[model samples]
Target chain A: MMRRREARLGWLFISPAFFHLVVFALFPMGYALYLSFFKWHLIKDVRQYVGSSNYAFCLTDETFLHSLWNSAKYSLLSVPFGMALGLAVAILVNQKLRGISIFRTIYYIPAISSGVAIAMLWIYVYLPETGLLNSMALGLLGEHGRLTPMVASMLGKPDWHLASIDFLNSTQWAMIALAFMSGWGGLGPKMVLFLAGLLGIPQSLYEAAELDGAGRWRSFVSVTLPMLAPTTFFVLVTSTIGALQVFTPVYMMTKGGPDESTNVVGYQIYQEAWVTFHTGLAAAESFVLLALIAVVSLAQFRMMKSTLVGYATT
Target chain B: MRRKTWDKVRGALWATGLYALLIALAAFLLAPFVWMVLISVHPWNTPIPAISDLIPRGPDGQVHLDWSNYGLVLFDPNLPVARFLFNSAFVTLTVVVGQTLVSSLAAYGFAKLHFRGRELVFALFLGSMMFAGPVTQIPVYLLLRSLGWLDSYWALVVPGLSSAFSVFLLRQFFMQIPAELDEAARIDGAGDFRIYARVVMPLSKAALATAAAFTFFGVWTDFFNPLIYTNSVEMRTLEVGLSIYKNSYGGSNWPAQMTAAVIVMLPLLVVFLFVQRYFVKGIMLGSIK
Candidate 1:
């Protein structure tokens, strides 16, 4: 009776959540799976069995490969750079400096202020004729090109057959531009998480390291790096998951534009569903996406598991 | 070697690290915004202009700010942003109320009620978080369609009433309350609904507030679902309106396009500043665990 009573109470505490989850989330997944094996049209009453054709078609699709590559490039570029910047900011603000909170707030402004209005804003900044980057590039070119003329003069390369090579169109530059956007948008949240982790670290370790005749850089490497590993792991796992699932900027700014150079898996699923109205194909694509996300996340989790568990229980 | 020299060297390096990181991030974050603000004030529709001058100049050759973009978006017959705003508010408000109340009640049942397979059910809820709408949209649409709710307010309202995060958050909060309180109320001959309403509801304000904020943000920021389901401009949300105008402005109207983006963002900005205290407390309490 005692065991039964305890089990009843536990059951009581978990059922409502289970029910809501089942109806809204779990059921949807099952239903989505069932739908993926068939074809459905919006305005027409047509239902045809396609079996695994949709899945097979994705293997041969050029758009799918492009989207997959773009997503891969974004993850490779943004995750590492975002972490570097985040760690640098976190260490800076960890000091007992005056007016540090002001800097913290200023850095946080971009995350909360994400808007569709950025299209016009970024366009001006990247405009070839009068864009801030180009004008700056032109000035730098006169002074001796850092990276400007090589990129601008890339169309003159005898290697590829292209007349005009715009950044959004050039296969080399398109993903990089998107990666920059992700890195910029991601800085604030990652910085805040690192700040929280830094505060949680004991100050005595640093002082003890200093007393042991460790130089500043050496102490940071020996004490701080290992101590902050857990936080870094957490932030990286979450950000990479988010980076892989990126959809908004591509939709708002690129629309898989300049010959689908910025197309990603998320946008591909969107295009399949919205632009082409292939709900079933989209479902299959989404399942593929879900599997991909799960696999990547699991690999990251396993890799980070040893490093992220805090040392000294600190 | 002087201690003073070492101290000065360390401080300079730290400052260098601080300034470089902050400035780079701020430029990245702020550049688009700065560009957006400038474009909103610019006198063209193009993101790029062919003119020799990048900066705005009035006919009198003096630099002057233009306010016509706001007037055009607000007053133009070709666009009805007011309708979109109304649609957005209605959808958000409805979702907030429905998600909060239903999710709360369901959370109470999970946190308090007893039956079979409860743990399995709870496990299922956690598993569900991994699934995004790409899987569910068609099924849900079919469900809504069968009920003849396509392109209607019910289509948007009914499906979102059970936010998984809200239910989970509320369940956690509800679990923290002592079980003896419920036992005492039961001894007083209180019905289950009375026990929930007169007792549990009064104590769960923080969790409910968290649910409200989450629901509000989800609904307000949402565009994809509404865009798919909604057929008419009247029923379309502000984000959709902002998207349509981004392409349809039909001229070098970068400034006006920037104005549109700013206007779409203004409400969330205002709400963020207004309830920032509550939002921070609520979301952190709800999620970080």
Candidate 2:
């Protein structure tokens, strides 16, 4: 009787949340999977059964494949460099310096700021002549600045000044620009995580390294890098996942333009669902993304478990 | 003694170099925000000034500043930005409060209550976190559309009212609270609800605040949900509304665009400055495990 009463009260406490879980999370996952096997239109409110075609179409679709490729390129461009910068900054700020928290807070501002606002701000930053980067590249005094002509002459493109490049409008530079911004915005959280990892390292290891006649650089390589393996792996997995799902910057800035150069999978899925209104296609595309993420994360997990953990334990 | 003096000199040099590097990195990270703020104060519809021209100089060559864009962006009749701000504030607050309360209740059940299948249910919640948003967004949107909740606060707040991560976070915290306290409350004729409310909730304020802070930041800066769900101008949240404001103003109106951007970003920065401890704690709590 007492157990029955406890179970009844437990149900009462969890029912509201359980209701939400059923309605929002579990139902949606099942429903999305169910919908992927058919052709559905939101406006027409029609669904037709089609076996395996949605997945098959996604696999063969050039635009979808390109988007997946772009997402991979974006992850490669952003994650490693961002993690490097994050580790560098983490090591820099881990010292017992005065007013260090202020710098930490300042570095973190971009991460917490509104993404759309950041995208808009970056559009201005990447503008041809009036943008911040171009202005700096052009020597900050408009076109008459000395470095523009000098650098242009040195690069054998005497007519081509840095200020003349429109980053978002050029297919070659668009993805790189977006990746750079993402790295900037994502650095803070990665840095903080690395800082935590740094703090967790045993001071005895460094002392032992010094006793073995290791210098600062040698100690960093032999001791610090090995100790940071797990943290590095964790950051790597999370940042890669984040880079794959990047949306606002592309949506606001590029709209997958400049010859579909910046059409990431996240934006591609958005276009599929909302713009094209191909609900079934979008569902299938998203499941493909889910599978890709699962595969990548599992691969990384296996790699870490086999190699990094072994190194750390030995 | 000479060697000691040389060591001190080298140490001093190293510290100076480190400080310089830190300051430079800080400036680099902060420059875009500073540029946004400076440009927002420039007069409306003007050509964006060069770096040398950034310091606004009127025709008379006197240093000048324009504050009109703030008024224009906030009170622009066509934009309805103020309404968007209010809508964002309402939805964010409601979701934060509702999610925290519901998560805590469920967390309490998992932490203290003796029930069959408790572990399984909690595990399900944690497992659901791995499901990507894109995989489920379409169905949730369809669900909202079916209920006629799109373009309204219901669509925004209802979908966000329960989070599994928050439940997991609070459950971890609640388990650390001594069970003796609850037992003592039970011995004094307090029911489970009272023990939960009067015992658990008050003691778990730090964890509750951490969960709420994370929720606040996530909801406030959210662009995807607000963008797809809301169709009307007035229904837009600040993040989406800021983008819409930028679109209509056209790219040439840098000053006006920056103003809207600043207005959208400033509140979060301010809130973050004051409550940054909670933010840091919340971030580190999840990752360092």
**TM-score for each predicted model, relative to the true structure:** 0.82, 0.94
The per-candidate TM-score of the B chain, in the order shown, comes to 0.82, 0.93
| Winner by DockQ | 2
Q: Interface RMSD, all models, one decimal each?
A: 4.0, 1.6
lDDT tens digits by residue: candidate 1, B120-223: 66666655654454477667777777788888888767777777777777888888889999999989998667888888989887667767866776687676
- Residue B132, model 2: lDDT of 44
TM-score of chain A of each: 0.83, 0.92
Tell me how far the alpha carbon of residue A275 in candidate 2 is from the true structure, in angstroms, after superposition.
0.9
Q: Provide the lowest-lDDT 10-residue window in model 1 chain B.
A: B280-289
Tens-place lDDT per residue, model 1, A174-263, is: 677777766666666677777777776798988999899999899978888887776776777677777877777778767777777778
- Deviation (Å) of B98 in candidate 1: 2.9
**lDDT of residue A257 for candidate 2:** 75
lDDT of 2 by residue, A56-133 (tens): 999999999999999999999999889999999999999888889988888888888889889989999899977999
Docking outcome class, model 1: acceptable
